[model samples]
Target: MGVDDQSTLQPMDDTAWTFLDGRIDAVLTTVRAESADRAAQGQALTALITSLG
Candidate 1:
């Protein structure tokens, strides 16, 4: 579905919002963990390069 299709959609009820919010939270948590892991890896790589120089 596209953004235009969403315009015709009805408003969600509390139950739907609750379910969507939970899913969003789970995705956000995963993204945050992955971001942190990448940052740590970058720092380690930088340290390794510095040590070699």
Candidate 2:
């Protein structure tokens, strides 16, 4: 799914992860969210590093 598609998804609750289909859209969605969060963290760290230089 595209990034625009992801914007329409409601944030999953903890229990929602347990009932994922065998096709695992929930797993993929969670992974994508995590990857986006990590990317944001990396950008924040990079900014800090640049500021320290």
Which candidate ranks first by TM-score, i.e. highest?
Answer: 1
Question: Can you give the lDDT of residue 49 in candidate 2?
Answer: 52
lDDT of 2: 0.44
Clashing pairs in 1: none
lDDT of candidate 1 over 1-53, digit per residue (tens) = 76434333324355554555455554455556745666555555554455435
**For model 2, how does the per-residue alpha-carbon lDDT over 8-46 read when each residue is reduced to its tens digit?**
332443343233332254334544673467655555555
* Candidate 1 off by > 4 Å: 1-12, 34-53
- Candidate 1: deviation at residue 21, Å? 0.4
Top candidate (lDDT): 1
Model 2 TM: 0.32
Every model's TM-score: 0.41, 0.32
lDDT of 1 at 35: 50
TM-score of 1: 0.41
Q: How well does candidate 1 score on lDDT at residue 16?
A: 53
